[model samples]
Target chain A: MKQAKYGLLLYIFLALPPVASLMESVMIVHMHMQLTLLVLSGFLMGTFFKQRFASFFNNWNQSGVPGVILAVVIWAYWMIPRIMDETLTMHSIEIFKYISLPFLVGVPLRDSWKKVSYTVKHILYIFMTINFIVMGWIYVAINQQICNNYLLVEQRTLGFGSFAFAACMIIYGFIWIFSERKEHQQSS
Target chain B: MEQTIKETIRYPKKLLGVNPNDAKVSLAYLSVAFISLLIGGLLGLVQGLERAGLIELPSWLNYYQVLTAHGLLLLVVFTATFTVGYQFANLSHSFGGLLPKVRTLAWVGFYLMIIGVGMVVTMIVLNEASVLYTFYPPLAAHPIFYVGLVFVVLGIWACCLGVFINYRHWRKNHPGQVTPLLAFFAMGVFVLWFFASIGVTIEVLTLIPWSMGLVETTNVMVARTLFWWFGHTLVNIWYLVATSAWYVIVPKIIGGRHFSDKLIRLVVILLVILNIPGGFHHQIIDPAISQSIKFLHVFMSLSIAVPSLMTAFAMFAVFERTGRKLGGKGWLGWLKKLPWGDVRFLAPMMAMLAFIPGGAGGIVNTSNQLNQVIHNTMWVVGHFHITVGISVVLTFFGICYWLVPYLSKRKLTPKMNKLGVIQTIIWTVGMMLMSTSMHIVGLMGDPRRTSDTTYGGHEVAASWIPYEMVFAIAATLLLIGVIIQVYAVFHMMFLSPKGQTEFPVAEPEEHAPVAPLWTERWGLWTVLLLAVIAMAYVVPIVDMIMNAPPGSPPIRTW
Candidate 1:
């Protein structure tokens, strides 16, 4: 319980202009720290709510499919270079980034991940993998600046990151399918 | 039917037989690796201090010479020897024992590697090979250096061949059973190493003759291209060996069951296929390669990160399952329940954590456009320090804690155990300081591989001095950690009280009788691996050869 409270306080503290400004000044930290840490803070807060909202979560995400989908959508939104740029330029978007990541994405992911079937989880992974590949292709292929604030080079670097992420997903899918098939063959 | 099931479940004691000769060989390899690590680490500190302008080099030891020694000893000697020794232990324990012939060959390989390392070191110390570890020619080394490196590669190949023979014998006896996970991982690493070495082998064989003045000139671009081909794959081999520890060894110490054996095998197979060809990412900025080939290489490099990502997910899942079983509740609760105090578990876990940023930096590195900004900068130095330095080296240290004791039949003293923990903490803190500063300074346009950052007191270079100062301090911390670790390892091997300890093996969550047959198809996988390599290299190599320039004769810059 204390951990949850501390997490919330930490989230609020990080949201302060001084801290946020310092973090967002650096390109790598903006992505790795400000954004990623925001999600982690949300995750920590979600643990306290798990018991309290058990019935509500179970009713909405019994199979965990909806929650997983929502979380993925939220995550995919943030991966966009344009969205990242908006956080720097627009104040409202920055606030949204702070609030939505934890409550909407991180919280729901925690609730739904356990409820989802292994098959469904893998299917979700495939979708995420494709998402990364497409994002990477867009980032690398486009010569024009995707983000108003970041340099063209920074945008392209983000593209490579997307490619790496997608690659990992595809590899995971390959391994998952192979392993499952082997199990089915032997069991039958 | 019941008896067959019982036999399957029974522990295979025959496979765990202890051989004094094998132990001696393993110890010898480890000793060399440690010695290399200590020397390499000191050289790194010297380089860091030089970069900061805090120290003057004695006339005998130039900056480039120290750089070459640092890169060669740590990246090649320490990593290669430790991996071979660690894998030998794994194979011997899992297979019961290596055949006497195989054991004899392994010793021969060990001696050959030692001889090779000695020659390379001698040349570097004599200022005969200041070309840096890349040995990117036109800046040539003494012929002995190239020959010595070739000897090292051949020695590793011989050791790998022994592992393959042992696996074949095991398969012949077990019939339908899947290769045990550790053995499977060991085989995958060796196979990958074998194929990857082909490019370097060609490069070295050609370079040796050229360096000896047997040939008038050498193709500089072609040599570099081939070196990158061997280079990236070599890093992956190091990564795979560390991953093997994460998969097979870490789980046991933490009381976690193995993730599905099939999944683990699949990851290994995927690595075997994707680990090569990605080397083009290193050459993306080079002039000779076409844009299309470079782009394709970027994709391939991106793809290789997949297996590593899979490892992260699978490892986390294993931890979650174990923690839940031990009464951990909530989303992040499992993290706390882990045996954080145990150096064996803590060190590797921390290494995995470091890989998140390290791996992310790798993506930035592979970006063709982005490479123009950060390439050959301190950022790259920071990137690899996290990836290969902290992640790979620290994990190997964790393995040694238990492995040394297991092989030596000696127990780690409480004092040494305390020091081991301190070593890991200090290493983590030191790397954080050094790499963070390096990354930031790199973005400020600080060049790497240069002895001095202050280019005639230019404003830009002057601004980087503070970061360089931070790096020097970090190096000091790292040196202290290295000393403690070396002392601990030495004491555990020689002075610690003797006791028997079992090689830890985690049971799978669920038992499956028949192993997956497709995973065992090594010949097919090898063919696939070669085909991918061809797709990546054949066009580029052909292009370079067709439009050949007059090769350059050796230049001795120092």
Candidate 2:
């Protein structure tokens, strides 16, 4: 956890300083390169780091079949830009996500019927908390603002829809935590 | 407590459980919603007549009024009715018995809502409250409209109260055991609407009253804020209850056990939290709020996709596993093996079908740049028709097919029995054609509210006339489907049976070929948890630093 935090902080520090000008273009490009690597690292951590962080990954795996798919999907969605051209329309990408969703969601439901253990659920909560905390900090640092598109006004924010949905998930998280605690107390 | 019929009438010794009651109440609410749908259908017929110039249309039943009534009635009232009923039904089962007082209150609440809807319809017909039913400023309706609306909100408040009481009762009775999945979701939506009601309640009780000259100095911004509070969360309430019903019904139809009950509960909780604060998404376009706030809202709105995605996953997984276990071979071959004739399977099945177009349209509607071209256009109408209209109405029909026999205690006559599935296919196919045409018409610069054939000084061309004609034709098909439903349900309910009825009890039947392994453990929670994380990553920051403060001045954009 500490190492992850440090790595993120270092990436932020390298990315934030506005030192580059026409004379320092190389350095600016280097900074961009480093920032990309950090995002990549986070993506990997959110996705494949389960192999190395067995306990954490196992706990996360327990969050639910849906959560596991979501984590993978999010990671994959973020990395799409890195791997693909920037010119692709968001609509098309959205379509891709839509098509992929049924398959991703369906895959996990086939194998098991066991309830996600409480310990894994909480561990997932912790991981999500970290991810959000990091993303929130990035949003703050970058001075996030809504685009000037007409849809922005009528639709709310581009990301707000997703965010609102996520908030509902958080509410679920707390409910689970409390329920698990109560169950533990009863058993004890 | 009310001893009126305590002695003479014998209440059943055993109350139905969450699953059965969930089916009953959901179907009952759906039954009502579909009946009300005929009203909307009648309105659509009028629209077709007016558009074709076949009959002179009333000024009050102009495009905007009809559209608003249709939108709010089907999405809000119908959705809310089904949600409230589902909540109570689940409660009845989860609590191990009915809370008679709460049950009675729910019934009264249902009647109150009916009265309110009746009043709204009357006002629309009489040309009394014809300002277009939206939460925007400078348009006012009749005092009766406002009063009737108050009754509507009060009815919802009553329903919410019933849910709370029932949930508390259940918690009291069942100490250590996990709450019923459906009941747990009901509680979540119940909590959501408790807060949801505050905003709309204030708007209906205070702002509209003041606007109607019943009071002075009502805050428009305040009213707008409040309406959206109820408005947006109301969608969540719909999704939550429907999803709960989906969880119960879908697995059963496909011959599958729930992969993870706990995960589904978690998803319900996520839906509640995510759906509430996200109401500000509607305010994104207004200059009254800051650009940053809009950005924040966008993020939250997008985060909602995660759990929705989770639902997609769980549903497919459940169906897949069911299919595989029921002696189905191969990966996708199970799709063919699943039962399609069962009415119970049709309800949740239709919801999945409607979800495809509805969810896609939702993304387009929410996109910042895309909104400019489509906002207030026929495209906007088409989008919601796909989302709210398709999902809710299809589910309504589906629930009917599932529960009519159970509730009516009679076999649907062969004709009546088959009507449900046929009507469903007709409605689904008809809506796709209608909505798709509407979207194309919108893109061709057809404004939504105008009642004339002229746009920007040019009459619609002969080529364009085909789409318009198609819209009317499709509406007729939809009406036929609705009529068939009404005919079938009324016949089944009134003429079917009075004594205990018996039918074949269905076992779990799988639809999808393979079930994902993780569903049992974390399927629902994982999707919901990620969604929450995504939203939390965005909302507070924007609320605090980016969006205008809550009481900021209003800025107008059409």
Candidate 3:
């Protein structure tokens, strides 16, 4: 409940015109910081939905595979350069970005994260790291601007940001397997 | 209500007592630290006198040369050696003893650092490296000077490895147990040390090539950015070292229980994560970095204050709680119950007091508009003089009164304790006079880092002369203070009566909850630390590289 309340506050703050404009002004900030934070906000708000509609999640996400797939698919769709441009040009598409990133992608992630098994979680980590690296390589290597809204330099910045994200995922995954899970094994 | 030290400490006897081999390691480092303090203090006095127009230097001994030596010796050698010495001592005491390999590594580090310092000092003496401690680019030093710095960083890396190994070994051996507070601090200190040096090491390695003419030119903005990443975090490293004393040692000296263990660990974790991004605050007045980025950085810079504020609150709470326990009454009456007469308590107490002004000045320096007024001015010098000179150095001084005696298996005599109290007062007064004058003159538009204060008879520069004189006089007094402190350390080490001196680590109150196991998650913290560093740095760094100005060739302004 507390998390849900804070997440609502975060959602409102991110939706504020000043914040949205400021974050969107920078290409990497829009893709990396703002979009990631929106997902985070939804993940927090998922606590409320989980409690309020427990039976639906239990029925639909018992093994967590369906929810994980839905979240990854939605996230992958948004990562396409064309869709990112569409959000800027069309008001309806922009609204859909704000709605679907949280409800469609983030909410599913929150629900599936704990329900998934160890092997499934490990595979997810590998996929995300590889995905980010491949995206980063594309963004950096391309001489032309990939997006209608952003400059070539901004595109390169975004590319570096993706590599950073990839590196972080790799480190976290290694640590998770090596050390973090030991606590779980012992405590459980 | 008097509690015995033995009754308070629940650790095994072997762990509580000083191990002789470990004592040798700590003592060797401390000796080097004090020797650097003496040399650095003298250089500071000479620089002060030169700045005051009292003495013209002989041709070979330039003010900038002395200034370079002074800054490196004290800021780098003195602070670093003292921290390693003290932390290794803490690790030894808390862990029962250092691993044999770790001890060997400490010796290896010592020799490497001495060699580095030797090369650096020789360069300064030859007037080949008049570059100030920051070593800003375009001002090239001798190739050997940068090589010397490389050796120093490698030395530090060796010590960092030693700590990591010891800590890992401890964790493996003592499964499911919380690491002792002091050992935890050692881990945090070295973790920051190792990561912080990465940026500087990169800077120095590239600099070697540039200085050697192998590279045609180097990015000035990129170089400065890299330097500050290490530089700003180094400031926090000293602060963290002082906190180890304030949190663990001060409580026992004042006869009180330590603060909540969880909170202490949280503060450590926060400082480590939030610190590297704070390099931007140092570059606020520099060009090429956009205002929007600077605006974003304000949040990162000030986030460190959260842990700082937490520390202030925690220290006060510990004092008030202890003072009350000692039967003091009313709100502020608890203050009098503190051990004001004890040098171990008195020196650090004054150090903590100085931080009120020091921390406030730091805030001013962090703000964009405020920094524009005082950037590269004498106020920046004053700000650090108060923060590092008093807040950090005084605490280190406080640690010495007991730590030296403890290492030597000697007791601190009542007379020597009085001398320490006197030394603390002299230092406090000297720094207060110097820093206050520096701040006032800085606000009057006096620039720093130059010997020629009168500025060819300009009116504003003439007005600063009186302050400069005051600064010189204060420096002289500080020299006297330094001599007394050095004498005291030696006396405690050798001349004092041979007796056991206990290492004072405060126990937590019995009723306090067991600190959570989550606090031991260093891997998670390390990952987050990298992620945060990447988040803050990657964008601007990329921007700098892609849109860099024509890189500057090595220039010798001298």
Candidate 4:
């Protein structure tokens, strides 16, 4: 409950016009820092929602597969260059981004995360890593601007930025798998 | 597990002292460290006197050459080697003994560093490289100088591997147990060191070709951004090392428990995460970086002050608690209970005190408007001199008073302790006179890194001369301080009375909560470190590369 207050504060601050505009003005910040922070806010705020609608989550997110799929689909949609550009131009899409990312992506992801088994969690991580690699290459390799809102240079910056994120994910995966093996060996 | 650790220390091979083989490695590194101090300290004196116009250098020896050697020797060699020595000793003592291969890796690192340092020194002496420690581009060094730096980075990486291996081995063997606090600090230091060097390694790799004329030109902005990526983090690395001693050793010397173990580990985690991005403030005044980005990075730089303030808060609380327990009465009476005469306590105590102004100056340097006033001025020089010279170097000096004796199986005799107290006083007085004058004169418009700023004997310039003379006199005092410190160290290493000296590590308070298991999850911490670095650097670095000015060819300003 106390965490909800902090999350609400973060969400409100990020929602302020100046803050939103400043983050959106930079292409990399829009995709990486700002969006990730938004997801984090909702992840924090999810506890309240989970308690209030405990039965709803438990029924819909049984085995977590359905909720995980919905969250993944929303994230994959947001990764589109056309969708990102549309969010800047269309007021409805902008509002949708704010609401959907937090509730649909973040809150659902949180509810599903605890319900998912070990193999499911790892498979999801592997999926994100592979997805980032393909998207990163497209962003870097494409000749024309993919997002009308940003310049080609910014598009390229986003591409490179995506590559860095993917690199981080890969590194994380390596550490996770490596440490697990070491632990398993010790247990054996 | 705790009882086992205590018993391990109580009945060691040399009667509760460091193993003899491990002691050799630490001693070899410490000897090189002090020898570096001796040469670097003398160079500092000569450079100061020459800059002050009190002495003239021979034609064969130039001021920039001297400055470059002095900076490299003291800032890089002295600090790096000393940290490896002290931290390895801590790791060995905490772990009971180093794994056999870990010791080999340490010696490999030692030899690599020696070979690298030897090449760097020879080039500087031959007048082939006069680029100072920062070695910012457009003014390039000899190709081999960069190569030497590569070797140095490799040596550090080797040691990083050694520590990681030994740490993992410990964790595997003793499941579900937290690492000893001292080893935790060593982990923080090396992790920061390894990541920090990656930037400089990239920078140096680029420079090797540029200096060799294989590459016609290189982006100066990109090069500088990369150097400071390592440069500022390197400062924090030393700061982290100093704080390790403060958090762990200082409390023991004063006969008190350390601050909360959890908070101390959190401090280490926070320092590693927030450190690298703080380097952006060093380029606050540089063009091409947008004002909005600089504005944001100011907070990034100042965020480091959180952990520092925590340390200050924790240390004072420990002092008060210890003092009151020792029978002090009122609010301020606890101050009297502290050991004023013990060199081990007095030197680092002065260091923590020096950081008051030293850290304040750092905040000033981070502020955008304030930085404009002091950027590239002698005030910047004064800032590092106080921060690194007194705050960092003084702590290293303090560590030597015990560490040298403990490793050597020799005692810190009362006579040697008194001499150490005297040495600390002289060093403090010298650094104070030097840095204060520099700060004052810099505000009056004196530039740094210049051999002469007399402006053909102008009146305002002449006012700075008095300050330069203070620098000279202070340098002389400091050289004497250096001599006594070196002599004290070698005496303890070889000539002091043979006896066991305790390797002091402060215990935790009774009934303390178990430090959370999450603190040991360094794999997660390392990922967060990289992610934060990517976020801080991506936009600005991409801008520097994409919208760059024409690259500059290597120039020999000398």
Fnat per model, in the order given?
A: 0.00, 0.25, 0.65, 0.42
lDDT of 4 by residue, B152-211 (tens): 998999999999998888887667678999899999999999999999999999999999
lDDT of 3 by residue, B405-435 (tens): 9999999999999999999999999999999
Please state the Cα-based DockQ of model 4 relative to the true two-chain complex: 0.52
Write model 2 residue lDDT over A1-188, tens digit each, in one string.
55445544543454343521211122211222332344443432332333355574456446465555464455445432222222123557434433333223222321112345546555555665555444434333433232222122222322343335445556656755655345445546
Q: Please write out the lDDT profile of model 3 over residues A50-73, one tens digit for every residue.
A: 999899999999898998898888
CAPRI docking class of candidate 2:
incorrect
Model 2 per-residue lDDT tens digits across residues B296-324: 46766776777887888888887787788
lDDT of each candidate versus the true structure:
0.83, 0.58, 0.90, 0.90
Residue B348 lDDT (model 1): 93
Q: Specify the poorest-scoring 10-residue window by lDDT in model 4 chain B.
A: B9-18
Candidate 2: residue B341 lDDT (0-100): 75
Write down the TM-score of model 1's second chain.
Answer: 0.96
Worst lDDT window (10 residues) for model 2 chain B? B512-521
The TM-score-based order of candidates, best leading, equals 3, 4, 1, 2
Worst 10 residues of 1 chain A by lDDT: A178-187
